[model samples]
Target: MTAEPALRLVDAAHPAASAEGVAPAREQERPETAGAQTLRRGLAVLRLLTRVGPGGLRMGEIGHRLGLNKTTAIRLTRTLVDEGFVLHDRAAGRYRLGPEAFAVGLAAEPSYELQRQAAGMLRALAAESGDTVFFTVLHGHESICLSRDEGDFPIRNQLIKPGDRWPLGVGAGSCAILAALPDDVVADVLARNAALRAEKFPRCTDASVLSLVRDTRERGYCLQPGMVFEDSWAIGVVVYDANEAPVASISIAALRSRLGPARSAMLGNRLMQASKELTAQLKA
Candidate 1:
């Protein structure tokens, strides 16, 4: 066949052919599959339970806080209870973490070595300072309160308990972790946590957090002067890993009246010393 006739025949046979063909459409338009969403919601319920302490939460409160519908919350909690990750207190009309949850947490002990190592330090700090001491670890753009020790102080700052999660720049220990990071990392963390900070921690703007980072770097510790709660003040010092990277922090929280400038500085230095000891232990 002549070149023109051959070309015409090829075009007729493959009229839709192109150098850049249309990309295939996605098979699943949703961000997550139904099964994945159910699993995520289930985990969310479990995390929420961790934060509420022994009191647990009512079904309506859980549904309200998580934005889960009444039926969905019921189903998820029922499944978790059936699986032994949760327990329904029929008499109290509430749900709390069950034995399986503790088992799972215990199984993950290796991941919480810092928490284990810092427990003694936390107790000593709390005893010496007559204040509440907390151990927090960095997790993504947030920080998790791994443990806490209470002092004999008459009035304690009970704002942050174990299992509480905060954006990196919100709490004293979290701010210490964020401040120990490089400037670029600090910026990225602020950007990622901006929305949550605005909604939950309105006072912790990027600018304000940067200011705190500068101050922490200068002082070798963080003094959270009633940022989270006007009457609650705290001091924090970062603990470094063997490679000298910041991994976790120790913090002391008390009433603002108790944390005067001199006392704040003293506590900050004390925390720094405790952090150094922990860092040495981790290095060993």
Candidate 2:
């Protein structure tokens, strides 16, 4: 038995292979199959529609944005349209998410029930603060605006809207969520999101964001001091789950003049209260 060992094949170029002829634990990923590629492209189209809101995008624009040829885009979109996931507006020559899309989204609504729970609170906070209030949720390493409410303030910070997405820590609510994370996890998040943040949000350096995190922890809230836009300012607090894990954030955006030191602190307190109430509601 010691004299006869079974033959094993190993790729010489694979560095992970052992000297004793053991195979490597990992292999290079194979290319996606045609069917898989087509499915991925279709999903990309759907995601694009979600980001663009109700107006929708023209076929040509979709192709251009996705870097697909006209024929390929047309074929993919036509297939989706036939499947009822997308609808084509004959008059406008644009494609929008169809009833089937809404039906599908409804199936996943339970995961986003927080939006429903926070709707009244967001509106109330907006009215009380006389500014725009936003409810944002952590989606992977990014933050997405799930709902927005506007107050009677003549001036509005229109920089963000529902369906908008940003790298974690780029905005007030987002910063609050990031700040709530454990230090080691925050480091990981920053490392993973660094490239995207640099490409999309040049102003959000790691040092600056870490400073904001420290300040957020000290003050019990986050203050985005006109970083994204010179005139736009916001205050935010993190909402936690039953286990005290950060899940989302509530923020108020106003003009820089409206968010001076005194008012910023006051609004931050209000947001913290809302965060606590929302967290309790989710637990209940």
Candidate 3:
């Protein structure tokens, strides 16, 4: 989500698994050749379209970003259009990601299953807590929202929607995943996102984040106040994969007054239980 590919997993015995049992990547490197270079460039174009959000990008912007000349950009995009991986807007001259791209995304197995399984958990949690609930996968060094359900509470604290991306440690759900990551991964993510956090996440310093990680390790959840959306407080728990690796998180957000210490503990326990349920469902 942070300019990195989303994480998609398959079943333990999925065909793509190696002897070590990992899914084959959606994007694979091809031998270096003129044709392979063209294919990589075309894929890069599609990736860029995905990052630019729904409105997409103009040919000129795409060309400039990819360091391609206008002619080369046109040629590459023309091929993508013909192949249905890209959509061409005749009137606006913008190129957007097409249904083929979406189809390919849907082809990933476990992500859809996770989506289906987590939806009911999120709804049940939200209904019980009277707050907004979100489920996000740790995609690369970022957390991407997959789904959200609002509770009966009218004063909803909505900061992100499905498909929203934030650097790991940027939000409650993101921080929960970051805090629950292996120590090495936590260190690596902190180092990679250090400059970005300093520039953008003033509230979450290196020392503070490390403390949160320690807290999560000890207590099994993360509690952050006013780190993401202002005046919104949140508590979260991480969901692990079949191998017990942190893959995603489930979190609740609400007004500060609504999430008093007692209520926070109650909702935090609720989220932890739901996280367990989802973890088991994902593994299945």
Cα lDDT of model 2 by residue, 1-284, tens digit: 01222322223345354222111111122598999888878987887787677889999999987789999999999999999999999899999999899999999989898889999999999889878898889888878888878787765555665666777888899999999999998998888777656655566779989999999999999999966555678898999987898989999988788998999999999889888998899889
Q: Give the TM-score of candidate 1.
A: 0.82
Candidate 1, residues 1-284, lDDT tens digits: the string is: 11111111012234344122111111122588899999988988998888777889999999998899999999999999999999999999999999999999889989988788888878988899988888988888778778878787766555666676777898788899999898899988888777766755566778888888899999999988766666677899888987899988899988788899999998888888888888899889
Cα lDDT of model 2 overall? 0.81
Q: Which digits, one per residue and each the tens of the lDDT, describe model 3 over residues 1-284?
A: 12322222223234343121111122124369998888888977986787667788898999998899999999999899999989998888799988898899878755556667788778888898878788888789888777778787756655666666777876678888998777898888888877767655666778888887787777788887776445778898888877788888998888878878888788888788888887787677
User: Please, what is the TM-score per model?
Assistant: 0.82, 0.82, 0.69
Clash pairs, model 1 backbone:
none
Q: How far does residue 174 in candidate 3 sit from its true spot (Å)? A: 1.7
Spell out the clash pairs found in candidate 2. Answer: none
Question: By summed lDDT, which 10 consecutive residues of candidate 1 come out lowest?
Answer: 1-10
